[model samples]
Target: MCDTTPKTPIWKAIADALRSDLAEGRYTPGDKLPTEAALAERFGVNRHTVRHGISALVEEGLVRTRRGAGAFVAAIPTDYPIGQRVRFHENLIAAGRRPEKQILDVEERAATDGEAKALVINTGDPVCAYHGLSLADGQPIAVFESVFPLSRLAGMASALQDTSSVTEALRALGVNDYTRATTRLTAVRARATHALHLQVSEGDPLLRTSSVNIGEDGQAVEYGRTWFAGDRITLTLES
Candidate 1:
């Protein structure tokens, strides 16, 4: 008797081949893939089959399709650790990627109820707010808003204006060190502001982190919220 096992579909085979190529670094992140017609000609298949293969890659988060720009390799998510001492630049550097921070806005605002609770301050107390973008290898990874008690860190705004690093800014204001005291994470849909900042469409997935940092004296020094692009970062809990 002859074996009668079914064979894999050509489109699935194509997708497998592309996935292998990606794993082998045949195409780097952000590289545009061949056009559908070109792939079809190369694989001896129809355009519809090529489209199906591309769709599979999209579902697997290995490729992204633009309306007129064809498919492009998706960026591999960076592993970002959440720990007592979390430094964005140090983390990216350890991952062999360049890190950058862009300070978007800075202002002094009255603390909201949540902010006051996180920072252990009065609800109407003034706080210095810093809004910024964090990037790895030129791609936006997260948008962050950090609030500090103005009475404690009066020069935080000026320090932030001079440098993009929040740690450095705090250090400049005589805070030698701070550690993460608490963190809460949730999955959320990107809003208009977040989408614009992260270069993603509205309703795209985002990882939201709300955290509090404390000084050696065990007093809350900062309250921060960060919205990470879902496809660009993998959050890790560190011991």
Candidate 2:
């Protein structure tokens, strides 16, 4: 003789299946899930069962349903730490996200007034400008620009192109180490280009950071600004 416990409910099975997909990164933040009809077919259940299962996800804040559109995965803000020694890859790795960058532009340019002030250089002095977008698990999260005094960091552009890492590039230029000497954070609205690059609405909130990095000799090595998607990052200050 054989005995069996009551089988799991079909709706709960659907919910559990979808939850696993979300947890394993199959569907990232802001991604649309399968339509109710599609899910119902896949699960071999009725639409009612599918809707009931999805409702559990909505209640748990893992997914949101739009009246006419569809269910979408909810965004969970990634934790970012602000401190003297800040490394983008390290921070994202610690948060369990794959970090990546798309270098948009890099060139030697005349330092503007703001750049001069931040880098302690005269206006019109040559500077290496590096621009890029940062992504977390394939989601655009921030756009950044870093300016370096070209006279001090010769061939900076080539180094950045080779490494795509500020720390490694600076090291190639003979700057052994550096630390953040100043950090000024402000809340701002995304501009047209920023909005386009970050896939956010124009005028959406953005977290802006203006910072300067100093080398072991206490000389300014980098002047940088980063605009982060307001809804995608939770910045924390480390004491």
Name the best candidate (by lDDT): 2
Q: Which stretches of candidate 2 lie over 4 Å from their true place?
A: 1-26, 33-72
Question: Local distance difference test, per candidate?
Answer: 0.91, 0.93
> Least accurate stretch of 10 residues (summed lDDT) in model 2?
63-72
What would the per-residue lDDT of candidate 1 be over residues 93-149, giving only the tens digit for each residue?
998899999989999989999999899899989999999999999888899999999
The estimated TM-scores of all candidates read 0.82, 0.76
lDDT value for model 2? 0.93
Full-model lDDT, candidate 1: 0.91
Candidate 1: RMSD to truth: 3.7
Put down candidate 2 lDDT per residue, 80-181, tens digits, no spaces.
Answer: 999999999999999999999999999998999999999999999999999999999888899999999997998999999998899999999899999999
Which of the numbered candidates is closest to the native, going by highest TM-score? 1
